[model samples]
Target: MFTKILVALDRSPMGKQVFEQALALAKATGASLMLLHVLSAEEEGSPYAPLLTNFDYYPGVGSQSFEHYQKQWDNFKNEGIQLLQSLSAQANTAGVNAEFTQQLGSPGRLICQLATTWGADLIIMGRRGRSGLKELFLGSVSNYVLHHAPCSVHVISVPSQVTQAEEAPQETASVN
Candidate 1:
């Protein structure tokens, strides 16, 4: 019954699964898909300013550094653009009407805003399955979206084995 489905892509290992699920849902429901990827300022550094504050540099060196950061920012955004384009192509190839947006902001806030702006009836995304103190400390975009999204949210949880493999510490055998 969903006419517009928004998929929030985080580019995590779980991304492929999330896209596949969203694509399938859209196909089954004959819904158009909107793929959204947010490039967080904290993750990519601020785009409008150099991160190195309180520093003095030789003539032209400051400009060079700022240019370097700007190049990095462009590359970061380009990567997101390429990813969204690729995902959109996949959906289009599967006969689903799909469009994408790559924005810079808080992921949760951006996703909710886009969902409202796009009139999405359903949102599908992958959850890292963080809980307890780890989730509290790291914060959870999925959790925030679930609470604040304008539409229904479907969170595909990461598998336990995947979580364990990523988070579990290596063990060493004791010498007798």
Candidate 2:
């Protein structure tokens, strides 16, 4: 029975799309839903290492120094809680039993860990997420969850907005 389901989300187009699909499925199935978002750890190594190793950034010259942002640590954690709260509220309105979880570390790993902790019988997520290249290089969250999660995994593939627009018919050559 898919009584427990976990929906992974993040601040990415694919993440949002998967969340929407999961929500709908949760409603239809009368399944309890949980939302999980993971924050990456602070690597002592060069921050650019991740970008350089994974992303499609231009090698040397394209890299630029970032103006370091000093943000409140507690506030940063609270922001994650707030996102979970907001997501939970949406589920609440839909009459789904729901909760939220936030953890720090590799996203894919955290997602799998939370699925275990939450005792979710099913997990639904986007095929690609915020960290495309990094995930591609080190397995996407969905991919990891598919192999590692204790439950069944659902990967939702969504077409990009540009693809949708391109598929739409041309407005018109009006014949007056």
Highest TM-score against the true fold, candidate = 1
The lDDT of each candidate is 0.86, 0.69
Compared with the true structure, the alpha-carbon lDDT of candidate 2 equals 0.69
Q: Over the stretch 140-175, how does candidate 1's per-residue lDDT look in tens digits?
A: 999899999999999999889888878889778999
Q: Cα RMSD for candidate 2? A: 7.6
- After aligning candidate 2 to the native by TM-score, how far in Å is the CA of 142 from where it should be? 1.9
Query: Residue-wise lDDT of candidate 2 within 35-132, one digit each (tens)?
Result: 98776543111122243232235554342322221233345566667878988998899898888887777867777887887788888887643244
For each candidate, give its TM-score against the true structure: 0.85, 0.67
lDDT leader: 1
All-Cα superposition RMSD per candidate: 3.3, 7.6
Question: Which runs of model 2 end up more than 4 angstroms from their true locations?
Answer: 41-76, 129-138, 160-176
